[model samples]
Target: MKIFDTLNTFMLEKVKPLAFRFENQPHIVAIKNGFIVLLPFLIIGSFMMILLIPPYPEDTTSGFGQAWLALAKELSEPLWRVFQMSFNAISLFACASISFYLAKEYKITPLHTAVLSMMAFLLLCMPYQNSSADITYFGGKGLFVAIFIAFYVTELKRFILRCNLSIKMPKEIPVAVAQSFNTLIPILAVLLTIYPFALLIEHYFQASVPVVFEQFLAPVVQASDSLYTLLILTALIHLLWFFGINGALIFIQLWTPFLLVNLGENLKAFQAGEPLPFVITNGFWDFYVTHGGSGGLISLCILLVLFSKSKLCKNIGRVGIVPVCFSIAEPIIYGLPILLNPIFLVPLLLAPLVNGALAYFAHSLELVPAMVILVPWTTPAPIGAYIASGGSVSAAVLSVLLIILDALIYYPFFRLYDKICQEKEANGKEITQ
Candidate 1:
């Protein structure tokens, strides 16, 4: 026990400095900021995924299957056909943003720089028109190259400005030579090392993993008919989001098969008047499909209360409310200090689990109908929950109650965050004065 405790302390001590360093680093800071700014794109991507991926049905032979399947097929067919183009567009946007940022660092005309960046992005993303293979060799590989070039150009300009380097033809030769060398070496290395490997992995994984996960993991999760698996998966989803992976991606990837297999069991249990899944039974809202979120009104209210206190908190809180209402919390989760705050992290992670479990319990007891309808995740909280649960106003009210509960859960942590911010501000004032 003493050894274990000592090891734990040592680990904590090691982690703190690294965490602080990461939080302070400019690149890390930029990525976090960029992520918040780019979140709407991610949300858009998730919606596209949902529209493109066919939802699994409970019955395959029925007339509903024919109708629903036809609908699903029609929506998905065009998306799948044009998926490469869509992916290229997304990559180009990311590259463009990186270029714009790099240009700003060099004190250049960002508009001109961005246009150049976009051109490079397009060049990198354009599909080879002459290729005979069924799959177009999209130059998705060039995205990083574009970003690297942008950064290199920005840095070179900075260096030249600082040193007052001559731009005459003779002097420009050496600068151009140096820039060429800088760009070529990394570009070649990436092409030789990373590009082939990335392509290989992408192809291999694309061929195998989705099918395996669907056939294997889906059934195992569904077979148990236990709420614990769902809880674990939801927790995993939250953990992934914490690491900057979109939570919706995780949900959409695993949800169809998992939902198809288990939802039927859950609904059967609900109809038979037996114990329902633990999430709906215990929590006021079901997160997976019923509501875009778990804590419902409780969590929202808690955040609102927190927002009312501090300027930064208030601003982020206000901005995040609309997204949160639709079960999207990326803005709040990242924008707020909740990511690193020990006080907030506890509830940030646990509150959802608690809510899921409660919702499961409530659902099992037939206190609420098993959620059957598919609603968009971006729909507002109570309204979304109501519509998703077959227009249950009671469910909407419960969602409101859950949001209030979340507020209570979040209050103490918010106070802690507020205090920390206040102290930091005070210290800044002292230094300034």
Candidate 2:
């Protein structure tokens, strides 16, 4: 009891303060919201994955599989063009979207900053060949470069404003026209600075900016898809949630680019009919570790509804069960108040780590294929896993199995907490009577 209280105090005193600071920090806030703002672009572009690749093996014995494959082959070029326009050309939107949200966070001119960010991004990352820009880096491979430009260029623009490096218009000019004119110096600065550096990299290194930067981050990128890294990140996110911090959003700010890179590499492999090179991705994290939101709260909701003796627990379970089925956790988290409650802590923290181990091994052994599609996080876990794994039944089965296991993990703790609540409620009733 003493140890638990001490640990709880430390979390409130030390961890909470740091986490709150990061949450309120403008750049961090923007990155989180920027990803939220960019979801439409990601979802629409990622849906092209379904169209570009048929979900059947080449040598499948089923007639439907064979016919589908034939149709896909016949329509390959048009499908490829559709995909090429969306997912294949994703970085263009990613850079602009993140910059726009980030500019709003800074209370600066969003349109001009977004436009400038895109120009800077294109100048550095895109490569010209045969009178057309190469589209290879525009998807997942280019995401790392896009996010960097989004942050760095936005900050650079802020720095320019801070130093008053932007052009000043005549007093008689309208403010909108004046702000538009103010973008002139930042434009030249981007041209003078970013363009020259890109030219140097091109001439000296024989590579586009994205490729060069990816090479530098190759080690970190490769390590990010490992099982150990997945478990560590999962634990971090849950731990933050345990303290009532928005751990998933906070961690997503750092983890988003890596997850997208993994997603991109997996999509590439799926389209090329090769073994998937990444087992960790946005889909994997969404469906496996966080299927019912942090701490397997959906499972808790189920247990509370079915088995709890306490009225409060039963009410929370009834209200929370539906939203959690779709992966929302707020009602359960705040209502049951999982934060700092030692009774519920272990099950909440441990279930996802357990899921990560089993899921990683299952993927490695090819019991289920690595997810190739970026299914929305809000989609039901089993269904989302099915879609994300390119329509694999086994992925859906794995999600169900994990959910059941999570329910088992939370059961004992749920009972313990319910008994306590039941006692408290009984005491209150007697006093009132």
Candidate 3:
């Protein structure tokens, strides 16, 4: 108890401030908000993917399921085109979203800046002439380049706006028209700035901006695919949560682009009926690596409800269990006070790391197919795994196994926390009596 108290004090005194700043930093905030804007596109596109690629086998014996599969196959091409228009054009959205957020940060007219940024992104990444090209560059594969172009165009717009490089209109003019007039200079400035550079690069190197970034960031991208990187990132995410920051936000900023790129490739490969290519993807994290939300907090809830001696602990668990089942851990994280409570820190941080390691090996060993589909994060475990793995019972079984492992890991710490709560309750009652 003394050690737990000391560690809690140390964390509050030393770690909290750093976590706060890291989460609140301007660029970090912009990136996080930008991803939030992209979340809808990802989710809607995932539903389209599920519609196109049902969980059951494409070839099945006579049954309703078989008929549904046939219908899905018939509709698959149109659904694929829908998915392609949205998911495959994700880079375009990234440019607009990032610029929208950054414009808010810079106090500029968001719509104009966003549109201009999207234009700049297309100008930089797309080919000039009529020719065939790999379209993946316009999707997740081009996210890093899209992000860079967004920032570049937004900063340039900020400078131009500050310089008052605009046609001043009479106050009698309609505000919307005047604002459109005001955007002219910044729009032209961003285009002039990006378009020539893109042409120069294409002229000299015969590659688009996305291609250049892909080549330059290849090593980083490769590193992101490693198991060690996954462990480190997972650990970092949980660590931030220990200090009360939204760890998922940090994870999204640093990791989601890579995860989405892998997901995009997996989707294409899966549609081609080829063996799944990437071991790690968005679904890998959502369904495999962290069961019951970040750090497997659902396991802690289960332990509390089943074994806690303290009435307070049991009640909190009862209230939190429903949400936890759907991978929403906020109730347990804050209500159970796991935020800076050192008693639960080890399990909170360790469980997710263990989950990631296990999931990584499971994939590397060919125990299950790569998760090609995206399941909503709100989807409950085991079931979510089943869907994400395209109806693989093995993946669902693995999720249940991991949940049991998480419960085991959290059991001892939960008991200790329960004992402390019981002691406090007993002491308070005695004083009252």
Identify the candidate with maximal TM-score.
2
How do the residues 1-433 of candidate 1 rate in per-residue lDDT, one tens digit apiece? 5764564455457744555564545433333343344336533443344444334354667785567667757777665444434432434554456556655645544444455545543433343356633222121223234444445434444454466553334555676454444343333433454345434644777532223334445455544345676677667555544444444343433343234234333433433457544232111224432243433323643465455555666776777766666666666666763443345546656767766666666666666666543344566767766655544666677666655666677677667776666666656642110
Candidate number of the best lDDT: 2
Candidate 2 per-residue C-alpha lDDT over 1-433 given as tens digits, one digit per residue, 9 for 90 to 100: 8987797789889988998898778777766776677677667766766865667778999998888888878887877776777666667777887888888888789889989998888777767768987667777888878888888778888889999887777899999999998888878877888888888887888977888988999999989988888889888898888878888777777788788888888888888889999999999988988888887787889898999889989998999999998899999888887877777789878999999999999998889999888878999999999999999999999999999999999989888888888888988752110
**Per-prediction TM-score to the true structure, in the order listed:** 0.44, 0.93, 0.92
C-alpha RMSD for every candidate: 12.6, 2.6, 2.8
* lDDT (C-alpha, whole model) for all candidates: 0.49, 0.84, 0.81
Q: Which candidate would rank higher by TM-score, 1 or 2?
A: 2
lDDT value, residue 316 of candidate 3: 89
Give stretches of model 3 more than 4 Å off: 1-15, 55-59, 131-135, 429-433
lDDT value, candidate 1, whole model: 0.49
Assess the local accuracy of residue 365 in candidate 1 as a C-alpha lDDT between 0 and 100.
67
lDDT of 3 by residue, 161-229 (tens): 788788999989999999899988887887777878887877888877777788888888778889999
Q: How close is candidate 3 to the true structure, as a TM-score?
A: 0.92
- The residue ranges of model 2 lying beyond 4 angstroms of the native Cα positions read 57-78, 203-206, 429-433
Candidate 3, poorest ten consecutive residues by summed lDDT: 424-433
312: Cα error in model 3, Å: 1.3
